[model samples]
Target chain A: MIAELLFAVFFGLLLLGIHRKVIARIQRRPGPPVWQEILHMLKFSFKTTWIPKTASAALFVGVVLVAIGIWSAALFVVISGGSLLVIFAIYMLHKIVEHGFGLSSGSPYGKFGGVRSVISAASEIPLLVSVAAIAIFTHSLLISDIVSYQEVHGPLLITIPLAAIAMYVVLISKMPFGPFSIVESKELVSGYKTEHFGVWRAGLEVCNGLKTYVLLLTFILVFIGSLPFWLTLLTMLILVITLSFVCALSPMLSPYDSVTVQTLLAGLMLVYVGVLGVMS
Target chain B: MKKKNALALTLVAAGSGVAAMALSMASILPGWAYAAVLVLAFPLFVLGLGLYWMAREGEEDIPFLGY
Candidate 1:
């Protein structure tokens, strides 16, 4: 378990590093080293961390703990062959953490980010729908069970393409770049994270990395089937690279626009799931 | 001395948590032990945060948003 946590933290940061490098290369520039994020995290940890006087002290710090806790739980669930339902619940709870982070800060930017997060919570439904679609096909919510099913019937990506597409949309939106990143948009001055600094910020960074690792791992487990540990790690790396390219080429959308597109995508997935339900 | 001790305890707790999980992954420890470590990890982390808060030199007077 400790090894898995280390792998998630280190590899997750590496993914962020690759993301930056990929984006830089796409724009015809040399990016920072892939280890830049790790350096940044270490730097943040060494800096002074303080709470804002005007903020709710308990919630301000509590949210960071919650963020770390949920992702850690999700990582454990995924690594230990736990239920998809539990993982999905953790994913939903993450929005609360983001909301708490924003609301606790008492900043206008944070409030805006918080509201946007609420709007984005709509994406959770489609994510649930995607999970339900898998459950329908596999007849189990257990990660191991789903992987086993895929081993016999081939990857769900081929069998249930719409569900895969829905999950892809969710993954894109959850990632830092892309249209759904209104929570931390530059115009909002880093949005929900505007007030966080030093150690608190470092905690958030680690949470982000864990989230990336867990989400990608969940994707592979559900859609790509399970592989040996090394192969799984390699697959995750490749997927991150592919996603980084997509993020680089895409343009950011307005909050309203992103919400609209995501909702439509979710609705489409639900329709597909419903059709599949009727057929099966 | 108290602050330093708290910091050390935080590190120790975190390290033990990681070590517990690692050992479990390697099958050297029982699965239940890993779960127990996992349960303990968050509180230890929170304790560290609390100690850090207590040890922090000063508080930011400025509001989160420059009002």
Candidate 2:
């Protein structure tokens, strides 16, 4: 478990670094070094951290801690081969963390981000529907069991391509770019994270890195089947690189448009799952 | 100054935390020790970073400037 956590943090940071590099290359501009994120984190540790005078101090700090804790627990679940149901639940709880971060701050931008997070919660239904489809096909909800089933029956991607596509959309939306990033849209000046700086912001960065690892790992386990640890990490890195290119090439969508697209994807996924459930 | 000392301490703590994590992952330590280090690593990193940030001199009145 310790090893898994360390791997997630170390490689997760590297993943973000690679993402930045990829985006920079796509834009034909010289980007920060691949180790830029690590340097950023180190520099942040030496900077000043302070609570906003106008904000709710307890909630502001609490949200950061909660974000870290949630991602840590999710990492543990993935590493320990825990139930998919619990993983899905943690994914939903993440919305609460996002909402709390925004609402705790007094800034109107933060409030807007919080409301957008609420709207984005609609994306969760598609994620849940994807999980349901996997459970039905695998005849189990435990991640280890699902992996074992995949080993015997081949990868789930071949069996249910629609669910894979739906999961991929969910994963891309969680990233910082593309049409789904309205919560932290640039117009809101970084949105919920506008006021977070120094160490608190550092904490958020670590949390995000871990969140990315957990979500990508989950996708691999369910769709690609289990592999050795190194292979799993390599596959995830490749996926992150691919997603970064997609992000760099796409434009940001309006908040309403993002919600509409995500909700429609979720609805389609749910209907597909319903059809499959009946057939099976 | 006091702030410099705090920042130094923060650096030591954060560096140690990262080292412990790496050592544990490499499996150089006993199981119990590895578990203990794992538990301490993240909190140590966060606390050290937060303290270093908080102990800086002067106030940040400008946007997007300062430490």
Candidate 3:
């Protein structure tokens, strides 16, 4: 557990490094230095933060803090051999609480962001269902048990291609690339995080990074199974590269369109899961 | 701005490096399960990077935008 937590911290910072790169690519102008994200975080952490006069300062901070807390709970679920259902519930609850924070901000941007979040949350249901199916099939919700199942039954992907596809869609939906990024639109003035600044923003950014690593770890551990220690780490590296290219090449889909795509993706995946279940 | 884009691209390239490592690991492990890890490993890593960068950008504060 300690090792995973440490990795999450390091991986989260590494993500900041990637952000500097991504922002550079999106805008035509030359960007900051390579290690700019780290610098930005350092600066933000030290800077003083102000609460909006009208804002419920406690709730504002509480929402983001709780967001981190919920994510940590989800990660702990994976580490401690808990029910996948519980993890899913915690993840969902976190989203809801975040939405409440956005709405409470009483900013137009925040309201739009909250609405976008609702859309995003709705799309997550199918992914959660697919995960449940995997648990049902493997007869356990524990990450290690699922890994063991893969070792004995072959990688779950080979047997359940649709489920794999669904999982990917879920993964994509969670992060919001291009069109799917309803709540996080670059054009929007801060989207859900419009009012936040300084350490609060930094905390949220770090947590977002941590969530990314945790989700990736979940997918890899569940579907990929146990690799030799060194090799397992290596495969993780490769997966990140492939995902980055996919992001670059794939045209950004609008959030509304992403919803349509996710729906279709989910339906197809459901059919595939049904078939797989019957076959096995 | 161009520099930022280049940096992002470069960091993504690093993600590829991680993927390569995963491939080699999958090869040494027992069975196709390991191979599957090799296959999905790089993409998952990229996904992580993508989510972090994309989501973090959402947190930027705009001056003219209503708080």
- DockQ score of each predicted structure, in the order shown: 0.38, 0.21, 0.03
Return whichever of 1 and 3 wins on lDDT: 1
Instruction: Report how far residue B6 has shifted in candidate 1, in Å.
Output: 3.8
Which window of ten consecutive residues has the lowest lDDT sum in model 3 chain A? A1-10
Reference-based TM-score, model 1: 0.91
- Residue B42, candidate 3: Cα error in Å is 30
What TM-score would every model get versus the actual structure? 0.91, 0.86, 0.73
Name the top lDDT candidate.
1
Candidate 3 lDDT, A154-177, residue by residue in tens:
887776666666666666655534
Q: Model 1, range A238-276, lDDT digits (tens) per residue?
A: 888877788888888899998888788778888898999
Interface RMSD of each: 3.6, 4.8, 12.1
Off by over 4 Å in 1: B8-12, B15-33, B46-56, B64-67
- The Cα error of candidate 3 at residue B24, in Å, is 36
How accurate locally is residue A43 in candidate 1, as Cα lDDT from 0 to 100?
A: 70
Stretches off by above 4 angstroms in model 3 are A1-3, A19-35, B1-67
**Candidate 2 chain B weakest lDDT stretch, 10 residues:** B58-67
Clashes of each: 4, 3, 34
Per-residue alpha-carbon lDDT of candidate 2 for residues A119-213, written as tens digits (9 for 90 to 100): 88878887888899998888888899999999899999999999998888888888876668899998888787877777777778778878889
**How many angstroms is the interface RMSD of candidate 3?**
12.1
Could you say which candidate leads in DockQ? Answer: 1
